[model samples]
Target: MGLAIGWTDAGIARLLLPGDTPADMRQRLGQAGGSEKHDGQPELAARIAAYSEGARDSFRDITLDLDGVPEMNRRIYRHIRELEWGETTTYGAIARWLGDVAMSRAVGAAMGANPIPLIVPCHRVLAADGRTGGFSSPRGVRAKMEMLALEKAASPNGQFSFGF
Candidate 1:
């Protein structure tokens, strides 16, 4: 599993696809042969580390530069961000929240196309049946399950600490 992050003057520019090799990420950044470190983005890197260690809800505070994300998809992402760290909700439920039950599949597809994964908490969105749904992370559903478990363990109610 590989994690590559991109940063910009505003904040994190994006979370590159989890499966991208470091070289792939570098090429995307137009810095293929250069150092991974940027001039002043240590805070962004530290936030990623904090999330991995389960010591922080880094997404809660980070500013994401989602310049070209579609409006509907952005709406879905906003709702996903509102999801508690450990509590899981269904795609259908999100669609319903959007005032359209028919948009469940669209919600799922939006999640699959999410450019910033962990920040949006797409892992918290499951199938309506409560099974782990598709996760585009490098480890797929297993990664989603692990994230859920980690957050659950971190909270007394098995819900994200901030959920309540």
Candidate 2:
């Protein structure tokens, strides 16, 4: 698996997960107005690598460049970023926190549109019924589940179980 990240002067702007070939990743990065050779933030890259290797590294301190993100999505991303390793939340729970259960779909949409996935931790959001919801990664739900498993994430009831 290959991973690529893009950053702006503000902070990290994008993260491309595995599933694309190295060449494809480079092409995508180029299309996104970035060069594959830009390693502007090596420390952040190291942290991401450590986390991917099963370390409990937290990205809470890392800054993000969300210049064009909608206000609502920014709010949701902030909330999701607070979730620690091994913790999980439901889309409905996030919606309720936003003061409306009806916004569950909106929360899901925001998660889907998230530019930074692992760093923002959108995979931590599950379905209201406790099932793994949609993940925008190319690997989809499988990738989301893998991330949960990596964190040994607990269910909403506080019991650890990846079976969900």
Candidate 3:
């Protein structure tokens, strides 16, 4: 597993999760037009590393640079960022929060397009049937499950329930 993060003056701009080779991470970052420099966010990097090791950090206070993202997607990401550790929600629920349950697919699309996965907490969003749904990380749904498991393990009671 390899992790890479890209930061901008505004905040973190992109994150490549564990599971890719270093070369793959570099190429992906380059393709996303993010600089390969890892010098900007030492504290954040440390937090992320701790998170990968199953430490609890809601990360809600972290700022993100969603400059090119559409307004709807931004809204979706904001809502997702409010989800606490070990909490999970359905795409349909988020769609309804957006004022239309029919927008479930749209919510899924927004999750897929999210550049900052862990901070945005896209893995917390599930399918209406309680399925893991899609995760765009290199490890795909497996990575999503791993993150959820980590959060669950970090919970105070070592337990969590699905919502909506």
Candidate 4:
């Protein structure tokens, strides 16, 4: 299946198709590339900032721009993308969810491989030590830390802990 993508509205936390058009989704993500255009392209910027704000109503309704993803990473990332805005699961947790053992590191690698960090929310994952985990964005750990804080305040899964 093609990559199914959507967005969360930080202003009102919920996930939805931007235009309710599946064809549009296929067209956008069908041959997409890096995160460069995503960083500030109208709808793209809104989605990224919504998640970054850690607001509870993130996905209440928004548009998704999924396009190009490799099969391997897609297998892992599709599940990762479903992670709620404020909730987090560990690398180890994601591996087990994939029905695999000893693949926690591989899960971490998968998270890092996400082209759409804020959208896929790789920042929601963490090291076992409860520290903000790595993110592929240029902001590095700084971005991770801020994201954790944002979610901590509005998480429905309030189970995550970050050492800051």
Candidate 5:
């Protein structure tokens, strides 16, 4: 199972879930050493609306606070947060990064299980062949592609690097 939790912030219920891991994900959120005051639920809802309306940067840093994920999910999400914006990595590359060279599917599964999708930047994780894979949660998959495109265009590489 993936991780993270959501509370009604401005009526839009924000979730910060990531992939699963062996550790207690919820506990980790409590220990993340960061928190931000929500302007209110309406603002949060607006942000969600913007995100759905094709706003890639329309995300809050607080989304990293997954309070209900497993260890694997945390591991995957932590890695994702390391992304420097305007860049991407592959599921296979992530699996290799975690030393789970044989766990590409698991990496995909973890991504699928991500709760806080855009915030964790799961869309940044693409297929090995440069294809954008499945985005399990709500919102359009094409938007994910668009987000990657945005990042690619903004990145200095002129193309995103997986660091593989």
Candidate 6:
């Protein structure tokens, strides 16, 4: 499976998995951009492919076009985007970091609304008391747990392993 990235002269507008067509993702996210074939940016596609294959430790320094996302959700995503590989944070913690402990569900909503899945790393967000929380991606929590396992497997000392 390959990655499809929507872009304009500005930057990457949206990122989607091979399961959905770029046209579908653009329409779903209300994004504005022309899509280039995977060959157009072989390096990026390769990086994404490597990550999907569970051969890469982390996706570093990738840019996303978040212009269409809501402001509150943007704020929440910004905080978790910095989460290092093999690390996870709770929805409640993120809501608290945003200065409203009561926004835990709101945080969950933002995670569900996340358009750029792996790039934004929404799987790294968990439920309170270390639950798996919910995942909007295909395969749901299984996908999230698989990603966590991939990272855990690649970690230097396996310190990332945390039982649920």
**Highest lDDT model number:** 2
Global fold similarity of model 1 (TM-score): 0.78
TM-score of 2: 0.90
Judge candidate 4 against the unseen true structure and give its global Cα lDDT, from 0 to 1. Answer: 0.55
Q: How displaced is residue 14 in candidate 6, in Å?
A: 1.7
Question: Model 5 Cα RMSD, Å?
Answer: 9.7
RMSD of 4: 9.9
After superposition, the stretches of candidate 1 with alpha carbons farther than 4 Å from their true spots are: 17-20, 27-37, 153-164
Q: Rank by lDDT, descending?
A: 2, 3, 6, 1, 5, 4
Candidate 4, residue 115: Cα displacement in angstroms equals 0.5
Model 5: residues with Cα > 4 Å off, grouped in runs: 1-5, 8-60, 153-164
Per-candidate TM-scores read 0.78, 0.90, 0.90, 0.60, 0.61, 0.77
Q: Global CA lDDT of candidate 5, please?
A: 0.61
State the lDDT of candidate 5 residue by residue for 1-164, as single tens digits.
24344453322123543343525454554454323343434555556556544565535355444565689888888888777655677788898998978989999898887766666778778776665678754335565656666555343323433432
Candidate 2 scores a C-alpha RMSD against the true structure in Å of 2.4
Query: What is the lDDT for 162 in model 5?
Result: 40
Q: Spell out the clash pairs found in candidate 2.
A: none
Give model 3's clash tally. Answer: 0
lDDT of 3 at 121: 95
| Superior candidate under TM-score, 1 versus 4 | 1
Stretches off by above 4 angstroms in model 2 are 157-164
Residue 116's lDDT within candidate 5 is 65
* Residue 127 error, candidate 3, Å: 0.8
True-structure RMSD, every candidate: 5.8, 2.4, 3.9, 9.9, 9.7, 4.5
Over 71-97, each residue of candidate 6 has an lDDT whose tens digit, in order, gives 999888778888888788888889889
Inter-residue clash pairs, candidate 6: none
